[model samples]
Target chain A: MIDTQSSSGSKLVWVFFLLLFFAHQDFWLWSDDSLVLGFLPMGLAYHALFSVACSCLWAFACFRSWPEKLEQWADEAVDPDDNRSAS
Target chain B: MSDFTFLASAGEPVSRTPLYVLLVYMGLLLALGVLSSRFFRGTSKDYFVASQSIGSFMLLMSVFGTTMTGFALVGSSGKAFSQGIGTYGLMASWSGLIHSAVFFAIGIKLWSFGKKYGYVTQIQFFRDRFDSKQLGYLLFPILVLLIIPYLLVGLISVMKVVQPITSGMFPDTFALPDKVLPNGKSIPHPLSGGVPGWLSGLVVSTVVLFYVFFGGVRSAVWANTFQTVVFMITGIVAFYMIADKLGGVASAADVVKNHAPEKLIREGSIGDWHFFSYLLIPLSVGMFPHLFQHWLTAKNAKSFRLTVIAHPICIAIVWVPCILIGIWAAGLYAAGDLRIPPLPGGGPNANAALATMVRTLVENPLLSGLLMSGILAAIMSSLDSQFVCLGTMFTNDVVVAAMGKDKYSDRQLIFLSRAFIVGIVLVSYFMALYLQGSSVFSLGVWCFSGFAALFPLVFAAVYWKRASLGGAVGCILATLFSWCYFFYQDIFLDAGAGHGEYLVQGVMPVTFVFLASSAGMILGSLLTEPPSRETLKKFFPTLS
Candidate 1:
């Protein structure tokens, strides 16, 4: 996450990756575990695996983009004058 | 003739081209034109809402088509097939109720706002409420992202069913049709590939889009009336057919209870968590931009409420046929009385099983044609509105606003909207090409969750005195964050690939995110102080 010196707020983009990581880990569990009520279609099972894999990559993208979103949010919140002379 | 010849002859007589069916479809369209003539006028208001002159009866029928589509017809029936009577128990029924309740609670507020401001589209409300064109601009892209996939799925499914029925009209020479199957009953062998499926999808799409392009929402409403009738009649026919096959309702219920008890009884057999998670789906329906757009189109508060009251009964009736048949289908397939062909690899096409059920019950060529039309009607009724809304969002909110500076005239904007509809259809078609995951039901749920997250903010914006702009922004972003997380985990990570694991086990993490967002909105607005009394009074002049 990008550092916003003014308020030190965490960027919103990080949330996406965090969710994605968990989702992927969940898929792996679904695949390896024995579902007690596993009456689902085999196609559903296959697609579940596919969704998990795709999410992992999206999470990576979110991680990389966090700094940018943070910078943008900070820029929106603060005026340039406060930092101009200080810098 | 020998016994073999007799059997062969029987099969041959049962199959016939879908010629008269195409003519019937055309006649239905012409009738729609005549019925809608007096209702149609030149202005946008006339097109969008019939000048808010619609009565409760018409409003009720049209709204039915607004939400029910191929998914409900195909997917819900499939669920009933596998799950039994219990699927319609508390879980599904409550979700349906929540959807209605949210509409009444949130919908009345929206309709009131629309009445106050004469709002036309989803973007119009966001733009005015936030006091920022920027918010409308921001939302336009998101609406497109959500709506187009929905339109593509509806159109493709409709075409998939309608194609064989209309093949006789188009003929092999006209559309480069191939004779892969000896008749429509058998699946086509590996094509010495002929005209692409997309080509057929495009042809059907163009026809639906034409009315929406020329007539806009008015066309959608009129067409919806016919489509809704078709949906209900066919649904009833389907239910009766299935019920009869099962030895009437009482005997059929007994067979289902004994043979497919798991499905017949809704005793949390599917697991408590799974049943509960399903709640978010119908709840999300009222919040979808297109659905709300319909709400705003209502003539008065009384009509709106009456329409809401009628929908559940209509839906309950429509759902019965699909569910009962699904139950019967599971039993038949399991007992070796029926065979459901598997997809190329090994899995069942549970989605197509409903269509297969229809193909089984009706032997007459004409009746089969009518059944096919009912399915297509279900699909197209939903698709048209989706396209109209999708294209309108892209043109009105995104392209025109982004271009800025007296960018286009009203006529130009309307034309642009139509072009975007076609563009959206193409993009969604491509996406469908890549999709091999999730049944229509599951996919529909996933889509609903995202929009459901947005409902509360809008509700507060209209009704709460202290709903500050700051609160709206915060709520919107928070909901967005929670939605992305839930879908990412539920779909891609948990359902798609072996990449991530769920952090919070059930729908709670997602639900909590929404709750937190709502709380933030309430607190944020309360702390910030209300907008200037003058600003409020100007926007809401009726407030004494």
Candidate 2:
């Protein structure tokens, strides 16, 4: 985990997230007929790569920026009598 | 092959392979349901939410599976055939980003609250959070209304795709006619005695209902996991086999280029406005009732991490193949090597295009049946979840909320939920029959658009401390009115073009409706008294 509590780390994560969002709009490649490998269309191939890149960004965020505080609070505050009706 | 007549009686089969593959797949799902019930804790909560015992991988597969409906596979392929490659860009790519993003943000938060509050349905959560029974009543009808179109498409896709798979299984019952395309190519014909479209649909709905009746979301999760793996693997296998049948991927590309070159370009097919507006459509998943139920089943917050990370990749694996195969179908048809069932104005019935391609190109009936089952798996996976969710909402939100949860025994609750599900299955079955001949891709956009428009209500209820009771109600009303107006104009009033071609100046109505929804949320909340601090503290505990 990359010290997500740090201000710099949070900022860098946001930058990465925004970049991935914008990069999804690949207008320049819309009409490009060039195939990525031997067959995939340029626009289609670019999107495939962009989707993979988003997976990595999410992986990073999940690992580094996991919301530990929310879990701790919920765990602490959950009353034993709070509708525990199992069968 | 395309025209369906109700089979009068069962008959001997020319090829039993396809029907056997379908039976085996359905049996496996039923078996999974039976097996999952052994682990059921025998509580309504356990049935509905799986006792929040589901781990990260199960949660990931189940959520991804529930989200990947026939809309993603059959409908996307259909649109890709009718429209072009932009279909992938418009939905699959954008959904990969937006759906997972919503999971990471909204899903985890809702799961936390649900785990804390003992909530079973989205309506239950909001009913408490907003402290309004009236809001719950209002939401119940609208949510069900949105879900109807979504369910209709699944029924439509299953019925549409089933005819081709069992084409020659019954060669003696009904008279078969050869359909010929305008290009002089003979379309595939259905042999006389195959399973009718009605029986095929009944089998699907019955299997789903049986599994759901047994283990509820636990079965849905298990079946979704099995279904997800089956579809993705078979989807890729079908992809390669079809590409090879077309003489490799490059040869396939050349065919499209020679015939429908515009399909390869987004500017040529789907414009920027429509493409970008689809971002709003995936937001609808944030509010999907089945997905909300799936989120509550997560064992912990950590369960969501896998779902958030892996969802996009899973989407790409399934959609890229389906979209490409559709483009290839257009190519093959134009090259005079293949024929698809025709539309009214002489276009391919795009919704059935994916299955048609699989059956036509991949020659082995066993392989063809397995691939068809894989697509069926993809479609059926969501069918159970959606059906179970409607049951959950009706039971937890309408019945239990109105007649206190304490009034009913756990057995009675389970019985009631199952009864409601059976009724919904029957009603939806009849409604689907009534609404046949509509386009799956077009209807899917409108349905997703409605939920996408109303979804933010739950978001505000979860995240915003100031989102008032009135705001919740206002948001629901505005989204309902706006969605109705847009759907009417697009579907009934203006019969201009297909789904993506025309929608509020190249933009989908979801955009304007979403803006209307947001405006309702903002103005409605500001105009009303703020929420009680007790409610705020309960939901947003870290309110420093």
Candidate 3:
């Protein structure tokens, strides 16, 4: 289980880097004219920045929440009746 | 279409058919298929999922290879061609990545259950999860129905692209009977004439079917590894060659900025909501039977995880060339340097776009033949996977489910699986000849939507403790209801304004159906009592 999580964690890191590449591409959507609002200003750099922020937040959230879920699952495994307070 | 125009349009006339190269490629694929058939002396499990012993690398390759279908290459190129540089932005590029993410997030749990219960089909897993025999039976046909069109679409797209090239080279031998287009022009059928469409379809399908039949998950894995490498390199190379002809990758931006700005930008007329919905279309991919089957075949959690991670990166490489060349083609056409001959049927004219680009860029016949083979490889990779998935599901899930599990031997099941594979190919070939669809990409998207509608019930069955039998059944019914409604409203209803557009906004009816299923799963489970502990133990022994 530890090895699985570690490998999955490293994968998340690789994904983070790849997302960085997509962002660098300034991947345009449609065209500047079509984005009438121009509020978000679409470009690869912007996307890269946003993706980085999102990935980081996701990682943090996963780190914080995964253990609790794991503990709950483990508890259920030990005794399915114990966690009868089913969702 | 006559050979006279084709010869006249060429930059330079060359007699070489690149026959050796073509023979080499065809020989290699056939050899792989025939050689792998020897491994069929095993159980159905070995044939279907390779006894769950697939490695990470093979899994990764198969995932990438199968997903980047011929239509993905040509149809995506057509999209890039017609949409300009920005179509990639509109593309469900992140679908592969997100699907992988979903698998990691929820798939590990499902895999554990699969290991515990020995679940063979996705339908079987759902049956155990919901504890509803009725729901299992209800879903069996729906899953099969939804899967067939997706398979049909892949087969048609491959035939559309590969047939033309094959006919161009071996006109007398491989070309089929001529058909009169809607515009009243006669052109040779790529899959039908000398070899006959049914025969060629059967032959091609047989190659893929035979491999998957005997090789099962193992052969598919190994063959996919070879095919994926070829697909990725060929895609990158094709794009590079096109870009070099234009100038370079750096020059692509300049070319688009100056010549095809409209193509580069999305038009407001299409509506932002409709465009945004394109993003949601990919969600359905995660729910595809074939993809789920691949996930089920994973040897371990690590293989599954690695597959999810590496799959997306390969997607980026596969698409980069297609998108780049598409932009180049748009620029060339816009510059009045190329004339896209009118297609058999008058629509958005995407079919001729990629072919035109290949004609303009390629000079050497041998290189052109290799490049053509690359495209065919892309098509076969996707078609093979689709047929294999369809055949396996039909035999294992529907046929064997009705017949008691103990009644059939492993060899009998394997034989049935191969037979079904061939049967489906013939149906799809006939369907493709008369079927009127926009492009392979569009067909794929429509298929994804159909599958996505049911994903909620499916996902809940794996993860939700309260996903009841009633809920699973309701979910399947709701999805089908929404699917029929969408087909009637979006497709059948004569709202004909845009070019064969069926979806509304980014939200499809399937989404609503999925929501209904989610409600069913929650309410149905709560209203009824849970299954017995013994039943739960039998269903999910490895949960702990």
Candidate 4:
């Protein structure tokens, strides 16, 4: 697991997420109905691409901040008698 | 009710295509329910959350399916039909990001706590966190109230779906008369003869309840995986077939450009604040009681990797086709290829827009039946999960917790959950019949807003050590009050039906509700005593 204490990657992942959120507010293309590749509306096409970019950044977030500590705690604190679903 | 015999009298040959497709679809799910039950571990935990052993692929499918309900498929298209192409950008893109974000930030932590504490439902977590059973009891009714509308949504969508897709599938049988609204206008029955609403509704409700009752969470997961795949394929195939029927995707776009250019743009229909507020709707997934239960089913923390990474892409795949299909419907109306949409006092039955387009474009009965089954897949995927989750909450949070866990055997606990599931389904089924032919998709949004409004309670519970029991209660009451107040204004004071849009300062009610909830959370925490150190230490490891 990546170090949560000083991981710039964690911060960057969130920064990218914030950027994506802001980019999602596409006021510039609000009135523009022009098609991308002669099919997708410019707004719809932009958001479609935005969705892809979100996938990439979230993948990074997962790899960077996978919450190893939280999982570790759960593992350590798990009830000994749990035998829950045989994890 | 009068049977038109319109199509059959006009010499349209009747086929049993939709009947067969529906039977196969319903039968498949029932069989799955039986199959899953056979392997059941015969314990409460295993029944409720699949013993928390679901792996990555299963988690992805079940989570995606449970989240992508009738709203994503039916409501988005219907909303897109009414508003514009901006509908996709309005909700889908935000969902792609925000939903996964919530899943990452919120779901994993809850799963950790669940695994550690042997908690099964969200209420257990809240009760433990705030050290207040009162808070848990209060949140329970509110969540139940919010979830009921969604059940109505699934039921109403089926009521809408069956008639249109199966309009000419019979020889002047089961045809309904135009439903007379309180307003002067009426919705002409789709055809003279077709499948009856009660029969279809009963079949769907029975199928979903059967599976959930037998296999509980595991059955819901197994079915959701199958249904998610089915609907995704449905979207693409429907897009291809409808586009090809209209020439091509480009040609369809050209048709819209030439005829209903307004639908292609956002300015005339959607404003920036209005568009931005739609993001709040996606946040409801963060608070969905059903989705919380699904998260607990993950085999491990790492099982979420596929879900978080691939969710946005999955949303894009389903939503794009549904939204595009809607805009193309506008093109159909513009070119006079389709009739003027029948407007109730509020708006056209946008719910029918997608189904109507399918029938108008596709000629083959077999193909139409298959496509319609895909819509059923989308609806029932969430329905089964919601049914089981309410049961889980009743068993773990309400009954078992109050009665003392040691008092009841595992079999009795499972039985209580199953009994509750049947009750809710029956209640929702009756509600569906009571509110037939109403604007279901719009009411579904209100439910989303209600859930979205309470999201901060869960957020602060997870993130903030200073959060008090009072704060959690205050946050929930604020959500309830603000929601009820706005709902009152939008429905009674403002006149519910005609305009059909509910907004405060050009933004959805959800925006104001969310802000109000956050404010309540902060103020209540400040005014009241801080949570105990032991409680904080349990959740926030850094404090320890």
- Which CAPRI level is candidate 3? incorrect
Clashing pairs in 2: B1-B190, B170-B193, B170-B194
Q: For residue B544, what is the lDDT in candidate 3?
A: 30
Candidate 4 wrong stretches, greater than 4 Å:
A1-6, A78-87, B1-11, B177-189, B340-347, B494-500
Docking class of 2: acceptable
Q: Candidate 2: deviation at residue B36, Å?
A: 1.4
Question: What residue runs in model 1 are displaced by over 4 Å at the alpha carbon?
Answer: A1-87, B1-14, B17-23, B30-40, B90-92, B159-200, B399-408, B436-438, B494-504, B508-513, B523-530, B538-544
The candidate, 2 or 4, that scores higher on DockQ is 4
Please give the distance, in angstroms, between residue B38's alpha carbon in candidate 1 and its true position after superposition: 7.9
Give the least accurate 10-residue stretch of model 4 chain B, judged by summed lDDT: B1-10
lDDT value, residue B186 of candidate 4: 74
lDDT of 3 by residue, B1-544 (tens): 1101222342223334644565577678878877776764488887777777777888878776777775577777777777654455445344543555566555656665555456656776665565555555677678777776676665665555544343344454553456567779985442232223344455566667656766766677777778778767766776667656656555655555556666545554244555545555556655676766776677776575456555555655666567657766666666655555445554335654665566556656676667766776776776766766776777767777777677888788877888888777777777766663446666666677777777777666655655666666666776787677766675567443364455444454445655765676677667777766655544344423
- Please give the CA lDDT of all the candidate structures: 0.57, 0.81, 0.60, 0.83
C-alpha lDDT of candidate 1 relative to the true structure? 0.57
Predicted candidate 4 versus true structure: per-residue lDDT over B31-123, tens digit per residue: 999999997899998998899999999899999998888788878888887887888877789989999999988988899888888878898
Could you report the Cα RMSD, in angstroms, for every candidate shown? 13.7, 4.5, 6.4, 4.3
Whole-structure CA lDDT of model 4: 0.83
Error of 1 at B169 (Å): 13
Off by over 4 Å in 3: A1-30, A33-87, B1-20, B39-41, B163-203, B250-253, B267-270, B344-348, B436-438, B494-496, B505-510, B519-544
For each predicted model, how many residue pairs clash, with residues at least 3 apart or on different chains? 28, 3, 12, 1
lDDT tens digits, residues B451-471, model 2?
Answer: 899877977887678899889
Candidate 3, DockQ score (0 to 1): 0.12
